[model samples]
Target: MSATVKPRYQQLKDMIIERISSGELRPADRVPSENELVELMKVSRMTANRALRELTDEGYVTRMAGRGTYVSDFRAKSHLLEVHNIADEITRRGHQHSCKVLRQSRQRSRGKIAGALHVEQGVDLFHLLLVHYENGMPIQVEDRHVVADFAPDCLSQDFRTITPSAYLTKISPLQEAEQVVRAVQPNAAVRRRLRMADDEPSLVVIRRTWSHGRPVTFARLHHPGNRYELTGHYSPPGTPKSATGNVVELEIYDHE
Candidate 1:
């Protein structure tokens, strides 16, 4: 018995990926055109096109309508344990940040919302749904629940002018927080709002914050997996580590 051979398109894709991994092709470097790949690899035009399309979809490269395809820029990364505002994060990257408040109202907490906020099933809570954009590209969908006791004016604030995180911080300082990160397939609504492809997955960060030992807010943030990553750095107690210590770790999640 013999092992199966990969398709021609896959072989071409692997070759291009190898070049990228080896730094032969750097970010924004123009990739070989379909015709060029076909001539060089002796593969059909269809095969070359398929390989390039897949690379674009996978975020390895970006294709412009008239311009040629180029290697993609580094995906944006966020600090998992940081409580910074998304707008601030975007601006720090030298990109424009904008937000659309999809929904903002007072609602009664129930089921998972109640559990996350640690409130009674019917207790009033301020709910907010917002989509954040960086350089006009939708990057995150934020669904948040705020305990009324913590931020009484949550519903009145204009989210387009001020983000929920900023408002919450102004009302009560964050004392403690916890977060869980997961990768999931986006539903139709999420995909549509994020302007993502049908096959794109999402990286979701579910977080709960406390102020003065009381639950302040619970937020679920969704990011396109191809465009965002989460990272963290920490050290154990009783160890004086250097700035370049082994405690600095990075995790990269790539979606299929």
Candidate 2:
């Protein structure tokens, strides 16, 4: 009751975001178009457009020039994936999993996201943005780009219910994946999304996944350093058997 009244467009944007968070706006559900908003909310076309634009930027909806806008449901699910899946990690801890899809669309791959896939600049790629949850707690934010040719069904999948990681592995088996980790500070946008204190540090992991001997996707996962750790297993090209006559096939690497 005490909340102050915000601008008309901002109020509209917040209302849309609330609907998305409450599951009222299901994934892939189209929201009221600008024209509809102008009529229903008695707001100007510019105000309605601004609301929709903010929603799009916040990853609640996907806008297409001729196709209109629809809710996004992208998440990263884990499946013992020959690759890491963020959503799965939360479930493994006995936590209920969820995600707020920020964005999902076909974009021209470039820079590192392109380099990891070994694709040419402007190659068609599926880009995704999501904030991951565990037991209703925000844990990480996943920003990723996938090879369209490898997971053609990606856009159609509901990321809210099923993690994109799970969908990808199901459609195209993963052959190998490589991950790199580092520490960094959050930017203004990341800081706001993660709801972190100004001084809190963060850990970032970049992963490249391959399928059928070709790189298929690249992702950057961000986590609050204070609340998370990274773990993995590594083995050298070849190693002698141990004294117990067991081959050295596994090595646990837990990085905090």
Candidate 3:
């Protein structure tokens, strides 16, 4: 069976998002008006209007009453849930964040990874192994893979200075994402990477993200179970939808 094609308005939305991800359209920059898009893209005014209207509703752009629309100063967020960059999360908490790049290379997708990336086996992909630190203490082990076609220069990035999450999101903003939180005992290598105790469990967040309807990146973010957590807060059904997005809070529990 053939895959379903997206509507023209959705295509227009994706194009605008791609531009934003590439830094071609910076936050607060003026976006082309509906009339301009209709003329530039050769689409009907209705299509252009729907695209701009949806973008505004999704917080990607803000339409002024009198002035033109402008790109919103918003960080890229996932569709299912928020995926915070470790560096940004730490910085937001007023702590220093750093990382160590343990590995960066090209590898062929195999087994579950092939399916996870929505690519065939033996397809070449970029891989990175990193450990993130907060306030000088190791906190997260990030093992990630990127589809070669989506981010061809993934290997050249210095993850020690900029995290894979930050770099990838900038390359192709997330259109969709899924994450599974797990509690399990990690292997010796992962245990050593996060500097966890022998009996300590690991809090792992397995994530797969998509852009343009294809899965482009897969990651396993592991942390010391005793030290990290994720919590969610959503408005009740009766409450109005937030102009921003869902609220996700991170808490640290340092065990002795």
Query: Model 1 scores what on Cα lDDT?
Result: 0.84
Provide the lDDT at 161 for model 2.
Answer: 93
Q: In model 1, which regions exceed 4 Å deviation? A: 1-84, 233-256
Order the numbered candidates by lDDT, best leading.
Answer: 3, 1, 2
Better of 1 and 3 by TM-score: 3
Residue 224, candidate 2: C-alpha displacement in angstroms: 1.0
What's the lDDT for residue 190 in model 3? 92
Q: Show where candidate 2 strays beyond 4 Å.
A: 1-84, 231-256
User: Measured by TM-score, how close is model 2 to the native structure?
Assistant: 0.57
Rank list by TM-score: 3, 1, 2
Q: For candidate 1, lDDT tens digit of each residue in 70-159? A: 998855423235445689889987999999999999998899889888888999998899999999999999999999877887878998
Q: Give the clashing residue pairs of candidate 1, or none.
A: none
Residue pair clashes in candidate 3: none
